[model samples]
Target: MELDGQRKSDNVEDVRGRSGSGFGQGNFGRRGIRFPSGGGGRGLSLSTIIILALIYFGLRAMGIDVAQLLDDGSSGSSSYQQQSNASGAEQEMKVFVQRVLASTEDVWTDIFEAHGGQYDMPKLSLYSGQYPSACGTASSATGPFYCPGDRKVYLDTAFFTELSRRFKASGDFAQAYVIAHEVGHHVQNLTGVLPKFNQMRQTMTPAQANKMSVRVELQADCFAGIWGRKADDKGLLSAGDLQEALNAAQQIGDDALQKRAQGYVVPESFNHGTSAQRMKWFKRGFDQARMEACDTFSDPV
Candidate 1:
C-alpha cells in the first residue's frame, strides 16, 4: 500500500464527467461505443491501441463480429472539463491505482519474459457516470469489467467507494486486488484462454457457461494472488496487506454478492465462485507464485 515512491503507469485514461448523454435504460440505445484505432482520433497511446487491436482480433476470431460489437457514437473531444474539484484524498487514490497497475506491469513483464513471450499491458479507462466501450455502454453499476471487445479494463472509481462502504473490504491492498484481477483477465486474453472460453460459451448450456465463468473468475483471483506474492517478495506488502486482499477476494465472491443483494445464495448461478473457493485459489497463487500453478480448470475447487 506504500506507493510513495512507485512509478506511475501512463496507461490511465481519465474520462471523468465526460459523458454528455445518459447510458441509462432510456438513452442507452443511442450511445456510441468507442473502438480505438491508430489514426488522429483521441490519439490513444501505444498500449491502448495494442489492447484494442487484441480485443478486435479476439472477438473476430470468435465470430463475435467486431463491427457489431461497437455502439453508434464517436469519441471526439469530451466537453466536460477536468474537475477543478477533486480533493487530495481522491487524487491519492487515483495515484494508487496507477501504481498498482505499474506493479502488475512489472510482475507480468518478468513472468512473460521468463516464458519467452512479451507482456502487453492493457490500458485502464477511468470514467464516471457512464462510458462508451467496444463492449457497449457501461455505468458504474456494471462494476469493473474487462471488455474483451476493447482489450481495456473499464472502471468507475466510485466502485472502489462501493467496495469499501458496501462490501466491507477497505484497504489499499484490497483496492489493488481489484485492479490485479482485471489485469488477470487481460492475461487470460493474451494466453488465448479467454478466446477459448468464448468459443465454449457458444455451445454451453446456461449452467455450463456459468460454470466456465466461475473458473475464469477464480483463475483471475489466483492471478491477483500471484501479483500479491511477487509484491510481497519485493517488500511492497505490509503486514496485513495480503490478508486485506484475501478478504477482498472473499468479499466479492459470487455467493457474497448474491447474499448482499438478495439475502440468499444460489450455487448454480454463481459465476465467480464462492467465498471459500475465491480465498482458496488466491492462497494457491500466493503459495505457488507461478501462472502454471494457478490452473483451476484441471483441479477441482
Candidate 2:
C-alpha cells in the first residue's frame, strides 16, 4: 500500500507499557472475557477471601503483580499521554495503524453521508499485554476486537507478528483488512445490527447463537472488502493487495483455525464461517461496493 502522503488519524490512543485494568488473569475469547469464577454472591465468604489471598501471594512470589490485575485504572499515570521508547519497527507499525484508521474514517464517513446519515467515528485503542475496555479486559490473546459498550476498536499490535508467523498471512493490506474488519463491527453497532444481535443472542441457544454469529462475522468481512474497494479507487492498493486480504480471510476462517488446533472439526461450533464463505462474502463486497450487497443475514449464508 502506498501511504506516503496519506493522513493519519488522531483518534488513536497508545496505551502500550501502561498497567492494564480489570480483574482476574485469563485470556479473552474472540469478543468476550473469560473471567475465573469464585462462586456467585454479592460478597466473598471468609474462606473464599483466604483462598484468593493465598493465590495472589503465590502469583506474587512468581514475580507477577496481582494488584495490577485488579487495577481500576484510577491510580496510574494517564495512559493517554504516556511516553514510550518503541523500536523503529513498532513505531512504523503504529504509523501504519493510524493511516489505516484514517482511511476507514474517511471511507465510512463518505459512505454514511451518501446514505443521508452522518458517520459517528469510533476511536481505536492500541495496547500491549492487556487493557481495560467498557466491554471487558482486552488481552493480546483476544486478538483485535471492537467493543460495542465503548464504541472503540481495541488492538494489540503484536497480533500482526502472529498473523505473519503463525497464520502465514503476511502483507500490509492483510493487516489493514484486520483493522477494517474491526471497524466494520463499529459500523454495525451504529447501524443497530450489532445491538439487535446482542439482544437476540441472550435468548438463543448456543448452537443458534453460533449460527447467527457466523453471519455477523461474515458481514464484517464483507464490510472490510468494501473499504478495500474504496482504497483501491484512491490508488492506495498495490498489485497483490487484494490477494493478501483474500488469503487472510482464508487463513483465519473458523474452520481453518479449528482444524489446525484439533484433528477434527465440529460444524455446530463454527461461529465465523468457513474459508469459502469468508472469501465469497468479501469478494462480493469488493465487486459490488454497496452495503446492500453485503447482507448475509437476509439470505442463506
Candidate 3:
C-alpha cells in the first residue's frame, strides 16, 4: 500500500504509555465520569465508589499513575507526546495506522453521503501493553477491538508484529485490513446493527450468540474488503496486496485459530466463521464494492 501522500486522521489518540489496568479507568469509568442514574436519579452506589477507590489505590501501589488514565476533557484535541523509548519502526507503524484510518474515514463518509446519511467518524486509540476501553480492559492478548460503548477502536500496534510472526500474515495492506476490520465494527454501530445484536444476544444462548457473532464478524470482514476496494481504486494497493488481506482473513479465522491452538475444531463454538467463509465474504465485498453485498445477516454467509 502506498500511503506516502495520504492524509492522516486527526481522530487518533496516542495513549501508549499513559494507561494502566484498573476498573473504572477508561471511558466507561473515568474520573468525573457519570453513569446513568438509578431509582430516583441516584448517583453511584456506595459499594461502587468504594470499589473504585480501592482499585485506584491498588494501581497506585503498583507504580501506575491512575490520573494519567483518566479523561482530562482534552482527549481528541490534546497534543500527546510520543513515548521517548519508541523505536523508529514503531513510529512508522503509527503513521501507517493513521493513514489507514484516514482512508476508512474518507471511504465511509462518501458511502454514507451517497446513501443520504451523515457519517459519524469513530476515534482510534493507540496503546501499548494494557489500556482501558469502554468495552473492557484492552491488552495485547485481546488483539484489536472496537468498543461500541465509546465508538472507538482500541489497538495495540504490537499485534501487527504478532500477526506477521505468529500468524505469518505480513504486509502493509494486511495491517491496514486489521485496522479496517475494527473500523467496520464502528460502521455497524452507526447502522444500528451492533446495538441490535448486542441487545438480542442478551437473550440468546451461548451457542446461539456464537452463531450470531460469526455473522457480525463476517460482515466486518466484508466491510474491510469494501475499504480495500476503495483503496485499490485509488491506486493504493500494490501487487499481492489483496492476497495479503485474504491470507490475514484465513489466518485469523475461527477454524484456523482453533486448529492452531488446540488440534480439533468445534463448530458449536465457532464465532468468527471458518477460513472459507471469511475469505468468501471479503472477496464478495471487494468484487462488488456495495454495502448490499456485505449483508451477512440476511444472506447466507
Residue-wise C-alpha lDDT for candidate 1, range 1-301, written one tens digit per residue: 7778999999988777677365444543334455565556757879887887898888888889766445232322332222323545567767888899999999999999999999998999988788988888778889999988878999999999999999999998998999999999999999999999999999999999999999999999999899999998988998899889889988998888898899999899989999999999999999999999889899997
Task: Evaluate all candidate structures by whole-model CA lDDT and list the values in order.
Answer: 0.87, 0.90, 0.90
Clashes of each: 2, 0, 0
1 versus 2: better TM-score goes to: 2
Looking at model 1, report the run of 10 residues with the lowest lDDT sum. Answer: 75-84
What TM-score would candidate 3 get against the native? 0.79
Candidate 3 per-residue C-alpha lDDT over 1-301 given as tens digits, one digit per residue, 9 for 90 to 100: 9999999999998877654644454443234665554356677777777888899999999999877877564554333333333456667878888999999999999999999999999999999889878887899999999999999999998898899999999998999999999999999999999999999999999999999999999999999999999999999999999999999999999999999999989999999999999999989889999999998989998
Could you tell me the TM-score of candidate 1?
0.78
All models, RMSD in angstroms: 15.4, 10.6, 10.7
Position 206, candidate 1: lDDT: 99
Off by over 4 Å in 1: 20-87
lDDT of 3 at 157: 89
Q: Whose lDDT is higher: candidate 1's or candidate 3's?
A: 3
